[model samples]
Target chain A: MKLEKLDPTVKACTSLVCVILLSFQYLVSLNIAVFVLSLLLLLTCTRARGIQVLKLLLPALVAAFGLFVTGYFHGRGTRAEDLQKIAAMPYAVRAAMSTGLYPALQISTRLLAYAGFGLLFALSTDGEAFIFSLMHRCRLSPKFAYGILAAIRLMPNMVREFKSVRLAFRARGMQLRWYSLPPVFTMLVNSIRWSQCVAMAMESKGFDGDAPRTCSIVPKLRWYDLAFFSCWITGILVGMCLLRY
Target chain B: MKWKLKDILMIAVCAVLFGVIFLGATYAGGALYGLLLPLGMPSLGYEPFYGLYFMAVAFAVYVIRKPGVGIVAEILAAVIETLMGNFFGPIIILSGFVQGAGFELIFALTKYKRFDFKTMALAAVICSCVTLGYNLIVSGYDMIALPVLALMLAVRIVSAVVIDAIVTPRLADGLARAGVLGGYAVCEGVAKDLDC
Candidate 1:
């Protein structure tokens, strides 16, 4: 396989992408409608489901609820039956609850939006485009850009193992004790072993050979890519107008 | 030192992995449900937070053993994430710089002599600590009372050690074992035919 799909023709696609990314500056902060649409565009483009988005969203919910719930009890200065105490400062607890809750949610929601866009980029767009975009267009060193591409290819498995660790520990009748240290250790050992096997396999294939790299699956930008960017950016601009009223 | 094609491939791969990690971290830390926990300790899904970033850098250093490898990998990854319009944007890039420094400092401390497993672990821990300290300041985790700050730091540091030293390293090892990373003997790959 070609390491990157760079033939002179792919340049047309890249220029179109440049235009689309330019539009994002406008749509990213417009309003809830534009933002939601952008979110939807990202979601549909990536082909991820609503549930997937929700999974990505779960963290924001947890942080907000956790801090708010804790802060509420902590505010009353009455320790509930099962709640942890938030230091016995007079308004400190309340301040933490009051001041911290919104920020936590805000910060987290913003995180979700970012992740949405990120997941969109990863799921929808070809990884090669982004990698080459950095190297060929953004002036990033090829070494660095390709490294990221390699890692992205390897990432799903990392997520799988991360999930596997959580599952395997649960299956083994392990209880959550002190950050699940024991299970983590077990997972660590296994993962180390996995890395070794994979590394050897790669080398055996002469991947370690001192051959120059070449692009295998280069992406070409299409009208859709351009249209998508325009929609996102213009949506952002329109939202900004609405927010003003 | 001249740049090699192999070096570029490795750096690019690790950089993207960096993005995947942060995406996982933020979701976990900020998630409302599926909160993985110990009896009393909160799992800082963010534990691996910025730590993965530095690992990518360190991995570059470990694999290439070349100057600027760590920083370059990190900066490029941050650029990808930023261009995708990450919420934190370039701020993440800034963190990458400090964390990269943290990784570089470890190699410098070792005088670039040995790239042992334990030494790499030490670097991960130290760099993570640097990130934690900086995160506290930037995110205002430092504004909390002394005890809370201390607790958070302790939790973060320990988690960083475990995740960096054990989980991530081993995962790289496992992939190597599965015959994925066949290029370098930098701990991201298997040490086959060794005197074990």
Candidate 2:
């Protein structure tokens, strides 16, 4: 399937639903199957694009691993029974520890599932088309919808402006802390001014909220989107039913 | 009142700024979480970073003083973050919607009139509850023991208060004092004093 042809709204809705279902599912095999399937779909859709997905998934994977470890230690197994079992042990080894597989699997798989679905939706869906569909299909107000679109478009320039601002601060013998609030304030004030200019320009060009307007390109659901959605839905249902749970 | 272009632009620009902030915070928080997890102390990536999530939402409300601006600003931030290849993906958007609604509800209940420190703190509490609820549902945090959950909630609330309530109102006021927010709602509240 060509990435551009997929309806953005459909992709978003389908992936969201899949992620929700996968969150509830805890079986390791089922999760691995779903993750594999999602990965395959991603690769199948766009092999080159899948590389980007893999790159983005790294942080999520690390987070998932952390969650798994946290769940293993802090899970419900810390009750009095497990506490006694721990005290009597010669040492706290992996073998001596009570099982945490179920909960840990649940957490990691849920994280992976979220990453999988997130990549699927984000990698394939066009941001502009998604915003357009939000207005046309979801009935978001144009003021807000186009505002978001404008913001999305401003992201690159915003990044550039942030760099330039930081450079100016650095040249002035100022070192900005990564988590410090001062640079954020500077960037925000500057961006607010930029947004004002954009708003003025847009209003001058007659972007009246009360006025009727038409889109240059309208997004409509097509057969491929329906097929894509149904396939995922059926796969999820089957996966749910097959899991022994 | 009909929302003007300036209002929309404020929301958009703020959303972009905060979205970038959020992405950066998530990376830093992720690294911190990675280090802390091995130290046998888990923050779940929320305790340290939770404040960044709601700062923009509260600031947007303070600036716009509109009913749905919190959610609007948050959802736009979520979109921008998604475009920036957020590891949490679109689910962060869902979290954004829920978190923003938490603040929006508080602001709406106050009739969008109260911008005090107490109101912002209370709003942060509500936002923390929403975050906890979402985690319980998706992250299986419900399966954890009560003490751990309480501690996580405590950290989240404290972060939200310190950042969202304290820092954000002051920042918004600072921007207003700088004459940048001349036509916005925050300015209107102090218009007489500032002679706007």
Candidate 3:
């Protein structure tokens, strides 16, 4: 099934749970399975293009490579005695092949698994749908929910304002560093004013925070959402158990 | 406890702006992490940018001076960052919560009355420690050598204290002095100080 068809909350929860579960274990096979499965599903089922996914995965790949090198040299199991502990484990547990190699593989692969789950949720879920789901399913306050939706709408304009401010500064022959306060101050001042205007406009339109309101676009949960959640969780759990030997 | 529409929008806008910055920092941090890999301390790459992560919390609480503003602002920023296609994905929302709770605890202890530099610095320190503990688990910092871990902690604390604590308050005050934050608590505080 396509992940995009699933509820946003379910996708988010599944990704979070998968990350948490994968963080505690040193099972290389489970991490690889998750990373591969997520990637395959993302490519085949989701609308996310392979190129876009590859671009996003580049950072994860780089980070994983760095972590692998770090973990190999500085990992807790670097000592020879630590190597003995690995050999004593069952056949399935010695998948790392040598001392310090287990953590190197585990951490680097776990990073990939995390990136996979993260990409799965991020690429498939729509922002508006997620906020609506939070409101309808999670009982988020209308004040905050609508506030977020409005902010999302304003994001493009905010970006434009940011650029114009920087350009205006440059026009004055002032080169503002990224860490400079003047540009941020200008932006904050504008933001405060804009926020006031937005608030006034919203209030004028009878947007009451306390009053119960109905949403025209309510995100509903379906049976497949449940199925997807369970399958994702159980698949990882069972995979970990089997890999434990 | 009552939040005006204006207040909520203020938080939302500020969170959105900072969320964009956070996304940029994440990319920069990723690059730095890759560069520092050969140093055997790849985790230190993001420490310098740690202060930027907590700016939403500091900005919101300092200007709004309300209960729970820090947590709300931080989480909202995380949500915005997530929606903007941050590579870290939804897990950041959880990190936001943990990071928010760090400073929120400090502000709550002060009963939301004190907005002094001392209080803000202390809150930043507490926040750094809290996030460090969370990172130890999620990022597996516990696996690294102890000296490297300690260095990372020190750098993060200094970043948090310098930017979120020192720079943010002064920046907000500058905005207030410019007379743009007129309706907010920061403006009100400035007005009262002038009257004195």
Candidate 4:
């Protein structure tokens, strides 16, 4: 029942299928159905986490609305089918909303689907475990895999560093602009220094590419992973076959 | 190219730094795009803002001056962003891979020797083109008019050139001048073994 137990590759593959299915699908009903299914899955996994992801979706929703409006206003050359759909509306209203309906729907729904699947995978999966799976199961070289894991591990410290860097700027009576280049520049300098130190420390500790290592938490594909894959793929395939604009 | 531990650690750090920046840009761009939607401009309004996305990888490759650093930095950044609860989720990993490959491919084309502004600009343009293809697939850009698409592409290319080519290298030069990047490839001619 805990989706987190599912193999990351399985979750990743399912998410890909969901994205592809949503991208190709234009029917609002199908998109809504998949969205609901995704929402259910997310909510069932962890209510608090699901709420957090929904909070994240707010901006995406805003962006999708923009895309919808843009598609409606400037999409140009309404399809004949769309024209027939708009044939009955008032001339003024129809002119604005006519040709763009399909496009607007398609773009907005695709964004929703993207956000939904993104939530499912990002919320449920553990980054360290995922990297472990990548190394053990996905045949990724340990150098790249461990490098990425190190980056992920360093994220919290990086955030703290970003704040300190800003404060250091302000301490000198210099105001930092959000869009300015100085903050990022300082961060990069700091990061480069830290990376060198970390690297040197790691090397001194005998870490090397040729060394064989074992994982603390081994990733395994359980029956639920298979079920998760089958359920999502079936839903997506069925939606693709049955749903049309 | 032998990847030393420092090299790998450098990639991780650069990727994390850039990933954080990318996260900030996403929110800022999203808010800006939302603000512009009520006006008539929809897609084009956000294309120029997209240059921020290229800053991390461009700066990383410039400083690192190695093959595959672009891909490593990018994909690592995406992983960090995902761990930070990015709204785009795991697909960002795929986006990072595609974008990094495009960036790395251009440097590869140049045999990894040229870190000139022109090469950086070219690589940025190539990366944007690849991202545009990705947009067409996921965002349904094919549904829009050709003129709009052309305009968007043009703006994107210009943005890429300005941010990735001009700004990133300038920033790297600044970092080098500050003596933080003592042993980096960018700082090779300046000094042998300065304190980092």
Best by TM-score: 3
- The runs of at least 3 residues in candidate 1 whose Cα sits more than 4 Å from the true structure, single-residue gaps closed, are A1-37, A43-52, A55-100, A141-245, B8-54, B73-98, B108-122, B133-146, B162-196
A110-174 per-residue lDDT for model 3 (tens digits): 88888888899888989888887877777878888778888778877777887889999999999
Residue pairs with backbone atoms closer than 3 Å in model 2 (clashes):
none
Docking class of 3: medium
Give per-residue CA lDDT, model 1, range A1-245, as digits (tens).
12122322232233223323323322223323433553676555446567765654455345434433333322223223212322333465546554334333322233334334443443344445655655544555554454455545555665576677878777978666534544444443444444445545565665533455666654465565455556555654555455321
Best by DockQ: 4
Q: Which pairs in model 3 have colliding backbones?
A: none
* Model 2 residue A90 distance off true place after TM-score fit, in angstroms: 28
- TM-scores, one per candidate: 0.51, 0.89, 0.91, 0.88
**lDDT comparison, 1 vs 2, better candidate:** 2
Top lDDT: which candidate number? 3
Give stretches of model 2 more than 4 Å off.
A78-98, A170-183, B39-45, B189-196
Could you give the candidate ranking by TM-score, starting with the highest? 3, 2, 4, 1
Candidate number 1, chain A TM-score? 0.47
- Report the lDDT of model 4 for residue B185: 83
How accurate locally, in lDDT, is each candidate? Answer: 0.50, 0.75, 0.81, 0.75
DockQ of 1: 0.20
Off by over 4 Å in 4: A47-50, A80-97, A175-184, B189-196
For model 3, chain A alone compared with the true chain A gives a TM-score of: 0.88
Evaluated against the true structure, the overall lDDT of model 3 is 0.81
What are the per-residue Cα lDDT tens digits for candidate 3 across B1-84? 677777778878878877777667877888888778778767578788899999999998999888888887889888888887
lDDT by residue (tens digit), candidate 2, B8-123: 77777776776666667777787778677874445466486788888768988887788888887788677777766676667777888988998778878989888888898999
Clashing pairs for predicted structure model 4, backbone only: none
Clashes per model (N, Cα, C within 3 A) = 57, 0, 0, 0
Model 3, stretches more than 4 Å misplaced? A78-85, A88-96, A176-180, B191-196
Residue range A1-245, candidate 4, lDDT tens digits: 67777898778877876676667656565766776777788888744364586687787787777777777776756666656656766677666664557667766777877777777777788887777787777777787777667766666777788788888889999977877667767776777777777767777887776688876777777888888889888887887777554
